[model samples]
Target: MAGLAAAALLGTAFASTDGLARTGIFGSPGLTENDTSEWLNTGAPDFREVVESLRPSDLPLPAGRSWQPVIDQQVADGQREPARMQATGVHAAFAHYAVCVWDGEWLAARQAGDTARVGRAVEVIRGVPSWPIFVENDGGGTVDWLRSIAEAATHGDEGPIRQHIRANCTSSWIGVDQ
Candidate 1:
């Protein structure tokens, strides 16, 4: 899936920026960082059952540029639905990774102390997502906002944010470390 692929890319591609990558402030991936093998094996059965039970092709991506606001309002309202939280690995697990990677890129650009790169990266990463509004404590506010949008879009009971980013914002994957 595009979301999984994006997550994998974040895990490996932007290793420098990903705080989870030792270089990043987040530390590193724990024991479950092997690959998709585990997630696939476990999720396949349930996902198959869900597929068999639910109708296919029911999902539709949100209209152009509108989703960003809705997501923002939701966040501003402080609505973080735990039920909607991490339901799907693609949305939850992978989305988180992607944001982390993006954040790492943003911070590196900032830390490199390159004002121009930081500005460019901020612009690029910010535009990558529909709802660009995440609370990134890493100093890269725009990048953090974009990352938040990814997480919300993926985790929210809505369209495939992961797919959208993969298709439209591949360049956003370029972390500072990459």
Candidate 2:
């Protein structure tokens, strides 16, 4: 089932601004079918399940080393090379990792009733400067939507928040169906 979803998404060709159809997996240039298959089989986690079953113990330490630095460096490089910014797959890769981490933290905080942790996660989500880039790259405002959900989760019962996540969040990195 995952493979089918991945194939459906990754198999389709997208037209570039230059009016040419580029064929590649996950909208990334030079990605072969085997590469996509490997990612779908191993690299991509079932994020829907992850968020649904989140626990504080499962969360990454907020102060610990994170992928933020790598993401930041990618954005910095994009600044130097505008073409890199135009690469939608790169942005998706960054968003995939960042959102997974942020969502885990947010969900875990809510589960533990840790308002401070929740607030911190929300702040970080909101402060991500690459949000606009994600949107431009067809990420569909996922970061912004997650931020709003996190903000709302801070106010009251977390049941609704969890439901929202379950309903909306999917493993986009592997092209899973939402």
Using lDDT, give the best candidate's number.
2
lDDT of 1 by residue, 13-86 (tens): 22122221112122234653422222221112133332222222222221121223222322332222211111
Q: lDDT of all predictions, in order shown?
A: 0.33, 0.41
What is candidate 1's TM-score against the reference? 0.27
Check candidate 1 and list the clashing pairs: 17-104, 19-24, 105-176, 134-145
lDDT of 1: 0.33
lDDT of 2: 0.41
Instruction: Provide the lowest-lDDT 10-residue window in model 1.
Output: 15-24
Error of 1 at 48 (Å): 16
